[model samples]
Target: MTWFREGEELDDEDIVSKVDYTTSKLLIRKASLSDVGTYTCKFESEDGHKVEAEFVLYIYKGPSFHDTTIYHEFLEGADGVVLCMVTGQPAVDVQWLKDKEPIPSTHRSQLTIRSVVRADYGEYVCTAKNKIAESSATFMLHVFEPPEVFISGDQHSVNVGERVAVSCNVTGYPQPDLHWLNKQNGQELDMAGRIHVLDGLLEIKDVIPADGGLYSCMAVSTSGNASRDVSIHTQPGPPHYLTVTPGPTSVLFTLKTFPINGGTPIKSFVLQWRKNAIEKWEETIVAASDVLAITDLRPYTKYTVRMAALNNVGRGQFSIENTVRTEGKREPDSPAISTDQAKVEGNSFSVPLEQSDNGGSPLLHLNVKYKEEAEKSEWHKMQLPSDAKSVNLKDLTFGSDYHLEVEAVNSNGSSIPATFNFTVPEQPVSSRMTKGTVAGIVMLIFLVVFLAVDATCCYRNRCGLLMAVAGKLSRWKDPGLKKVEEGEGTTNGDVTLKAISKPRRSIQQSGVQTISKEAGHLTEVTCDKAPLTKNEKLHPTTDA
Candidate 1:
């Protein structure tokens, strides 16, 4: 017996042949696609008679996919379609399924996703069905999400010549590529310069006012890209805050500002803070200074703080809000008052103070009470500023002792009272003068008055009180000299004197010229222009 396949004689050693009395058989093993063809069996006898039989064979294959790729990827929110390209000897029916559930509108071996979402990602099964067999293939579907990015902080404040770091938080299916950009120039940040970026963190060294601006943090990936903006604020115009400290009952904020606006320096800052969700704002004002404390706040509360800069112009726009929470309630500690250092000047007294321990709260002010040491005197109350170094009491009575008490007050309550006694001094005066000194001053006044009278009399009458005294002294010395009596014949002061009417007569014997009239005790003398009375006869006559 002989076997032939596809019109060709079979030559494989694996073919088995058998012969019997009335039948001849040929067997073929391991039949495959290549073995599908016409087969012929030949019978030959020793008497030279030959016969051949041909049989047609057909091998029908099941359905199979064309491509070997079993994984698919698509961006989220994008339209995508996955087709199962199948082949087989006979045309087959195709269907699609996912998670063991049939997919709708997938009769054409194609799975369509409109606006792909994360829920569309998973294993997708494509099955081809035929009369003889059914085959299936699983392809993994992955949906890529765009990088969702956020900055650590929306705004970061820093002084000139400072360092700052900003971080970006990103999440995506595929890790995204991060880049930091400066919005000032709209350029990629220079990693070789003062700024650098590493692992989504941007670090800037020695930042300047020019470096302060909006920075873009971007994340790029195969799917898509996303970005967030960060603000780096410096000084001038508006102020960027530096520090915020919250206590039990107060909030303290310190803002960093340069001393310049548009050629004008900033004069002040308007700070505003309030509860997180409240609309009405609470304002606290004190003597205009650098104290930026907002006191008398509820404890354990969340607050939002902001501020605006004030210059020659009105207040600028308010700054970004900052969320803060005050600490829990805690009573303030007692303060120390330096009563020993108290000072008194005339009608007023001032008591000094030392910095106090405010515990968990802030010192609101100081209270002082005092009263005259005298019995049944009421106490007088006075208040001082929180930042005052001393408390002063004016219009106080001098030369009096008083009971004084000083207590430090805070939001919680007052501290232990410091009690002491103080004596107010009177107006200052020097030591009293001696009795002898007083008597001497009186005698000196009398002498001055008498001298003034004598000088006045002498000017009009050529006579004075000293002259009268001299006359009286002379009379007393001799007790024989006649003393001028008051109102005698004619007082010089009372009478008018006449002019000289007589010429002098000279006595040539002594070269002397005497007045024509003389008093009883003396005579007034005069001089003549004649030389020694012309050296002539000695005569005493009244002639012109």
Candidate 2:
């Protein structure tokens, strides 16, 4: 026995079959669209007899519409048909409903309208039904005339750097796409950071003079497209490139006019200048000229100049301020020199001079004269370049003072001579030798004074005439015999007293004193001991 579908033998790949001599069973696995057909089973006996049985297997699938929704627009009195194709098994039936309600003649898959009317514009639903399931789709039907777009609002005027918005009202059966375009250049305006478009409104943030033109708001649709132009006017901007050229007693100004003109022709230009911050401005009117000249200005004075353009609206913003100073008079003043900069070297010196003010004139030359102070020699003069500020004098005698004089000469005349006096320094060896001689003399004088003072002190202390006299008296009084005493005591001699000798303390040895002693005994004498007469017996005194 074998099973077949569509004239082809079915095996385990298509259907499973279990067979015996009298009964058979067929099983279908994983049924699909192609499996929904007639299936047959045939049996052949050993005597060549055949018998067959036929079976129809149907697959059921849910119904679904071709599209979820549709959008269509048609003019009045136009014929149109909307299709609602459904895909499913067992032949699904589609019905068209208007506003969720079924239409009387909408039995077929397509809804046909002989003539579209204004009242027929509403939501239409297409529902597909079958035994297994049903699905539906919706569509918006618009029955009206073609799009008629109009922009509302008149011409607009806005200042530069301001914000503006323009509206474009549109009338049509279906909503249309809005776009903003530059009618002058035919370029579409994009929704950028500075410009935006929402619904029918076009907005511009910080509008400039260049943005002033014919702007078109276009409404685009399937039926057609419409556009309208709006005139936009922008006010004039500030003037540019204002410059001033100074003269001796006047000034000339040149500038460019404001290009936009604020939607009006420029009538004139206003020029203003002031001496300084403390002065009021002086204004002048010029008849639409790019250049103007102002005279009778103070010489060598700084002034601030500015200009603005005048139009039908008003005066635009002034150009950036420019500062200029008029030239001074022709005759120059005397050049001032710094006398402290007169420098002297070994046998050379340099005189540096600077002109404090040019005094409306350029220098032609400089004359420098120098002469020795003690000599009867004539002054020597030298000519210097106009730009030279200092003159170097060389080969001069060392240690000799010289007087220098400098005068500046211009086209007008020479200035008063500037005088300076300077002395050249001595040679290095000569200066050092002089200093050494003075130092040596001072040291020798100090040594002589030191020796004299030391000799005087030694004579007064021990080796002078007073000590000689004392020694002679001691010798004559006791020529052969001498008295002796021990410890702290007094001694008497049997002799005439010539000069009494007192023990003296030596400053160099603190409290130690020197005393004369007899030949045979040693004695310690204190400064407070009393004198004894000759021929008296000597006695030793002891500390109690």
lDDT of 1 by residue, 266-312 (tens): 55667678775657765543322566767677888988877665544
Model 1 CA lDDT for position 71: 84
Going through the candidates in order, what is the number of backbone clashes in each?
Answer: 0, 0
Clashing pairs in 2: none
Q: Tens-digit lDDT track for model 2 on 1-544?
A: 8888777886664334333435577755576777788888898999999999999888888887765449877786799788887788878888888977789878776888888877888899888888889888888888865566677675787777789898788766566777888775687887665766777788878977556667888778876778787877775566776667776566777764355575556778788899888889999888875347666678888889887777654667787888999886544445556667767777888866677544434567887898989857788999988678778999997778888887777655777777778888767875557877989989999988876775564466544344446556764674443333222334453322222244222332222223444454433333323444453335432321
How far residue 491's Cα lies from its native spot in candidate 1, in Å, is: 99
- Displacement of residue 7 (Cα, Å) in model 1 is 2.3
lDDT of each: 0.70, 0.70
- List runs of model 2 lying over 4 Å from the truth: 1-152, 159-162, 182-187, 206-211, 246-252, 256-268, 285-301, 310-314, 326-544
